[model samples]
Target: MAPRSSRGKSIRQRGARPPQPRAVSAQDLGKLQGLAGLSLRKLEALRARMRIRQFSRHSTIYKEGDESDDAVYIVLSGIARLVCLNRKGKRNLLEVLGPGDVIEIPSLLPDIHHKLTCETFTDCQIGLISPTALVEGIVGIPFREFNEALNLTVGRWWTLLERHSNFLSQTVREKIMLALLDLGRKFGRRDEHAMIVDLGLSGQDLADLVESSRPKVSECLKSLVAEGVVKREHRRFIIDSVRIQTSLRS
Candidate 1:
């Protein structure tokens, strides 16, 4: 017989219980719903198989026309922008995506190359599910869940189209107001007086998004500053919500 060790004797004396598995909570399920419309059972299944990733500000998550072999990503935290570059190297901002937005789905279509590049606007957490695995998981999900995802994707695309249309039709002042309203809705931090846009975007970037010239954007910003509708501190723009709305009607 093998000699008994002191460690084995100590374990026997303690009579240790087996480790208990963690139970999933309702809050966890609700949080997962925003990420990918995942149900509790589906989320638990994905936790075992999917990989999570992080990206820093200005990091390129995927380049335009890259091969789409890996996985689809869902934004878990922070903001990202999908952009397309023109022949003149001007970036047209397609959309600014926040938490719960999906990325790289356009690549999944047969013979379709990625049309836009995705870049992180801040430090971000993303969840990735392999294309093959995602398809497998979808088979297990109810039809309603799949339809909900499809509808959400379609709605986002429609909104992007509308934004592009508005950019073409709106005047510079109107564009600035709309942009501020959008930024306020998505990334603003509320203060006593107004909602402030925390992102530090360059004038050129603002122009590109608004489909205007950089000089015009500068002039418009200065005019707004003079009117007390907006203020610039360092590189960020702060909008006085009440003043901006009043200025829009004038």
Candidate 2:
């Protein structure tokens, strides 16, 4: 038998990273409640299959032109942005997603890859559910349960195409108005009279969203403020709910 080493061993291994604490709980999956109408009872079987990740602000979760995301990700808390690179390599903002939003419905597809980059806008907790688990978690799962999920994937592309076609025909000012209206509906918080969008978007972000330049977007925003359409306060965009509703309908 070999003799034991005489030197005392260190309990903490040098150059080894510390273990990270789990950032999510089984109880935190309520963020997925709307997707496939998931509930605690529905998630019970998949509990062992799920995982969580904590992301810091401005961290890139995935990049454009990547071959695969391979699984579905749900934002349990905080915000994430979808960005695409233009032909000139400028980053264009596609959308900002908050809690409860799924990264892409196509995550259900085994061979699918992302068309855009996803990144955290703030410190975030993300829930991960693999496609394999989605396939086997429930009885006869893939046959019937995947219908609505697949429909969302088609609908998402339809909406994006529709927006692209509509954008080609819009004036710069018109484009800005529609873009603000879309964001207001998607990310806005409401008080008594106003809708506020505070997704850390700047003029450049809006420009990216609208596929315009910063100067053009800034001019349109200033014009909107002058016309009582949308206002900027404390670096957040604000619009009167009642007023914008009328304007949108007109």
Candidate 3:
């Protein structure tokens, strides 16, 4: 028979060990959406119960239909997207998330499956806390500020759906143009003459975001290129913010 390794022998003797909780800092707490303006003492208390996690780009943090309401995930850094797959298995992009964003506040509530999948758009740092710990952690924040933060968080989804409704009246060209402008503002960096969006997204990803077919999006991109509203160089999009805004106004 093969001899047990020293590590295995030690584990058997010592039994299982619990993972240590990661330390949280005031700066970290300040970045959280609804938890700003918290006192140092409160921040310290919450820090005790939090754990940090890292995920590579394109990783799924939570899947749709997951039954466990284990912990709340907060984005400490990098971008993430909420997506849903329909009955036909068609992908629909819901929202883009960044630092200080929570995956879902409602996940803290009991007896609910995750309705949308949360996937990282870039290499991400995330903070996690149990619902119980979270409840105990935020005991002293001002109710008004906390409530307003919740409203704004929920309001963003409503706004996204509202924009989708508004897009129904717009042409495919107009829709892609609007999508480009929005993404540019969120993810683009300003160069000498344009805002460059370098998300490394493919044509299909953009189509998912714009809620249009790839063929139509390709056609609109050609139109946009011809009109000089947008240009592409090495897979990055160069957007003329001034021109697009002016076109929108006109």
Candidate 4:
């Protein structure tokens, strides 16, 4: 890899690689498919206790410190985001949960409060499950299994927090790279040498994800292109994953 001097890009624009999330499959397509292992009787009980709810884009599901309703929500379709706010009231995108992911699992416990805000980015269908019914469906007679499920739920949030901090503590350029990586891993396709992100993220969208200015993000993208780490093909962004993983590192 050539030095950053040629592109006039700073070293801080580089990102250290993260182990990418698995490419989403049919199981992620929606409709609570992630819980397919439950028995028919259990599922029937869950169905009896849960109801479908819909919300339009940009509608808030709940806010931080909102009282937990002793229930859980499953994303049936569309994007549901978990966001955190700063003291100055700036919104930061903490995590974007798509089809089949549970929303804020820990909040389903009794007497808890939500620490993050949840909202829909597109018109969405969600499954609202009561705590008792959920416990019946997934934790019947197997207390150990319930604990394992709880651990997985917490682990997802833990991973999100780690990545969120990864962005907050990085240089602007690195933050941009990390944001792109996050989006790409969740919504990208690989064909040959390039990984194409298909989320259709605009400059402002990227800016919102990293809490940076769109102009700065544009500059960072320009540097990425000049450094031969990324490219634009039609309307999509295609990144040379190999180079990007080792460009600034190299």
Instruction: Evaluate model 3: give its lDDT.
Output: 0.64
Residue-wise C-alpha lDDT for candidate 1, range 1-250, written one tens digit per residue:
9943311121111122223323333344347435446665766666656566666655666665546435677776676667665444545565666766677455343233334577665566666776556656744655455546755676567446545543443467776776676677677888888788877877776765565677788899999889888888876778887777776667
lDDT of 3 by residue, 88-128 (tens): 45445555676676765445432332245677655677777
Clashes of each: 0, 0, 0, 0
Clashes of 4: 0
**Candidate order, lDDT descending:** 3, 1, 2, 4
Task: Note the Cα lDDT for every prediction shown.
Answer: 0.62, 0.61, 0.64, 0.59
Which model scores highest in TM-score? 2
**Pairs that clash in candidate 2:** none
> Residue 75's C-alpha lDDT in candidate 3?
76
RMSD of 3: 11.2
> Looking at candidate 1, what is the lDDT of residue 38?
64
Candidate 3 TM-score versus the reference: 0.55
Q: What is the per-residue lDDT of model 2 for residues 167-210, given as tens digits with 9 covering 90 to 100? A: 33445676566666656766788888788988777676666555
- Which candidate number would show the highest lDDT if scored against the true structure? 3
Lowest lDDT 10-residue stretch of candidate 4: 5-14
The better candidate by TM-score, 2 or 3, is 2
For every model shown, what is its TM-score relative to the native structure? 0.54, 0.62, 0.55, 0.61
Candidate 4 ranges beyond 4 A from true positions: 1-48, 67-69, 86-92, 108-114, 141-175, 208-212, 240-250
